[model samples]
Target: MVPLKKYPNYSSWAFLAVMAVGALFCSTVIAGVTGQFNLAPVGIFCGLLWVIGGALCFWAVQAEQDLAGTGLRSMSVSILLSFFSGVVIFQEPTLLYFSVPAIACMVIGIWIPASKTKSVWKNWRSLLSGAIFGTYLIPYKFSSLGDMEFLFPFSVGVCVGSVLLVAIMTLKRKKSFGYPKIPTLFAFASGILWMLGTLAIFWAIADDGMFGYAVGYPLLQLNLVVNQMWGVFVFGEYASRHGRIKLTLSTIVILVGAVLLTLSKM
Candidate 1:
């Protein structure tokens, strides 16, 4: 694979850290409450929390936000890709059903143009990293597992894939390979976290609505926000690294969004 064209900036990376934290908290909390209380109310509350919190994130971060380009483009990519969550969450949805379309949109939305400057191999690498990264970050539909139904297999898949991605990155040694050594651990952590987190949320939501509804839904946004930020910033992503301020602010927005949602739940 040819080396990707070099860039002068990497400020956006900060946001990824922000989003990861959000995913952890929100998913954990939501699981706690919904598993415990099983409240229909929790979902409704989350809906409201997300709306206001998302708006605030947009307000704080989008100074030059435009529909046609830059901010909108990346966000659009994230949304479209995230839309796969619906597929995963739906009852008995297959991997390809959700994965294919989501992957395609991501390719069109971000990868094609990116390919112009970078090699095809690098583009594919980004695709792999991003897809996995996104998976770990979101509130996936397939998050559930019936009694004795799906825990071991799921964990096996996660551990395998994570190890594979790392091995690929190491063996391939593609110059523009997006993953960082340690940060990629977060991706693995996310996979394991999602599995355990899902069960935890499942249990918690049975007793804890505040933790479930308020913390979980907004936390979804939080995870995605940082996921998007980091995926793009560290490895490769929707936008090329513009500068530090953009990255930092984007990161801040993700964290704040999670915080706001969690608080509103209270």
Candidate 2:
């Protein structure tokens, strides 16, 4: 476990590097499999990854107060991995100039440290979560199943995987399946929002060809901006003026990168 301290040490850097590598490898393998496999098995398998990824995301937010920056870093990693997998395995076309610059901008932007006490393990967990989240659409693009058809099994897999994980976690923690009403309501609301957003993606992809997927992928990454706002304004992730400036500049870079990526696909 990485100790939350004034600055990350060499061991901290090592942990982050190893975790990032592992996350990247997992994403690449998933992408490769997605490009070649049928949706039946792939959807099930990918759903399981999502559950693991979701858990990592939870851990990440719990470990750090700068929720937005953490989310952005993870998303930035996914952006690069997604583009690579799309082109290599799925034969998607991309202009080198735009794509390379976009990736560079995102990486540089995310490199600006978000918190004083960054936990390497938690940060890497977020990266792994983003990696898994990034693979959500890869299999769907290759599947012959209709949008709704694929969504059904995929959704089922997600539910099953989530329930199993939650149950196991609860058992290990010796906790009851109970929560505060307000938080539970908010969680439900978020679930609804997620479902709607997902359905929209499915519809867009089904209607607009791979072009839609490519375009939507980067646009959705704009959520990083929102997360940052929540971090700064709502969560007060950065109190110092200098830190806030760094976060702002990083957000701009990330947006620019996202736009460039979108244009590259078009």
Candidate 3:
């Protein structure tokens, strides 16, 4: 794979294509090995939602180039929606005293970094992406199929949706598809990594697992801390003193909220 410096020049379509291909391959192999090919309608819908949400997230990342900020925005929304799903849809009991303030902290934390970016449209993309991601799992919760069983249909949706999106965008732009080898390899690797993470989350939320959607979902949002570390140490994002301060404060607040959410499960 090419160095990260070459990323800006690579075609997004090619990136999406290779990533989807990689994820599709992993999902197909997993489903085949597990012999769990039950294609519930809700599973298909969940897959479609994942593709669209993932595309939006990629777009937002391209636009902002600030992993921490985009991650915070999207994951914040995901956390909020998952909390709502837990309480309302699943009837999971949450201590309102903890959850209400947790939500407030997350909302405020998400808002703090908004002023860092000039493009409101980019922020909207992140929010919309997160919203879709948050709700996509709801369909999976409704599906009768087991987590591994649903992966095949969901991966198929991802591939199909990605292809359609690429085709539409290519036609609109009147450009031939460009496949840079290094970027394609990196993208493919990313997809594989994503599939692994998805599997972990699926198990976490499965009925047989340790944590249900309410608890497991929010727990995953702790990735925001890792995102921030990459942004600060690797990318040199939030270089300004003021920006650093805001980022620190917001991260602390977000962590507090996440911790509170976990405790609410207790």
Candidate 4:
């Protein structure tokens, strides 16, 4: 945990900037190496949406202390929304028998952790963040470029968005942009890591990839499992027996839902 209080003067925008810079660098490198440098308007749009959504996600993470809750709320919502978008808008096959219950379990999982939180504003932010993260990939569906090819434009959008954020914050707060060195490095590393994961996701959902949008998208939400593990073991979250029980139960239910979703596509 980067002691939030220790850096009273740290700017969130500064952190976001470094992270975006890292992502930009990674994406540029990958695109160059793969020779996948096709640009499209939709890709740019996806990047812009990611900027807003990613910012909200960063804020939600900072505001919410429970890492599991943060992952569950945002990711569950993202899975549900993206699943439906794949089915309804993209005209993907509908496996109601499995999907209905899967959705129910996910909703239950989201509700359990969400009910524990006292901050209404934080809840709203998490929900909004999930909404954006969920739908930002829609434009990719329409683009003619390969998954790897879309990364460069998408990263450019992220960089542009970061710059806009820094400018806005500087002007509004009347303060220069600044951040602690360690946090900046961590943020940059995180961006590189995120870009790597994002590449896999893009490949998974690509038209020629192993899984199409409906299947690949929901399967990726399994990341919540890893997120929860960090919360429980590393962060010592849900230390109380009751909290642990709820976390375990919710996670099981969510996983069950995810399993059913996987089967639904078969």
lDDT of 2 by residue, 14-42 (tens): 22223333333333344455553234765
Worst 10 residues of 4 by lDDT: 1-10
Q: Which structure is stronger by TM-score: 2 or 4?
A: 4
Number of clashes in every candidate structure?
26, 0, 0, 0
Instruction: Report the error of model 2 at residue 42, Å.
Output: 4.2
Estimate TM-scores for all models: 0.31, 0.76, 0.89, 0.90
RMSD of each: 14.2, 9.8, 2.6, 2.4
Q: Which candidate's TM-score is highest?
A: 4
Q: Which stretches of candidate 2 lie over 4 Å from their true place?
A: 1-42, 113-122, 203-215
Give the C-alpha lDDT of model 2: 0.60
Candidate ranking (TM-score, best to worst): 4, 3, 2, 1
Q: For candidate 3, lDDT tens digit of each residue in 1-266?
A: 12232486676666776788888888878887888776567766787788788877777777766677788788888988987897789877667798778777876876676674376664798889889878788878876778888788887778778888898998999986777777777888877777878888889888776668877787787777787777777778888899888888888887788778667767
**What's the alpha carbon RMSD for model 3?**
2.6
| Residue 104, candidate 3: alpha-carbon lDDT | 77
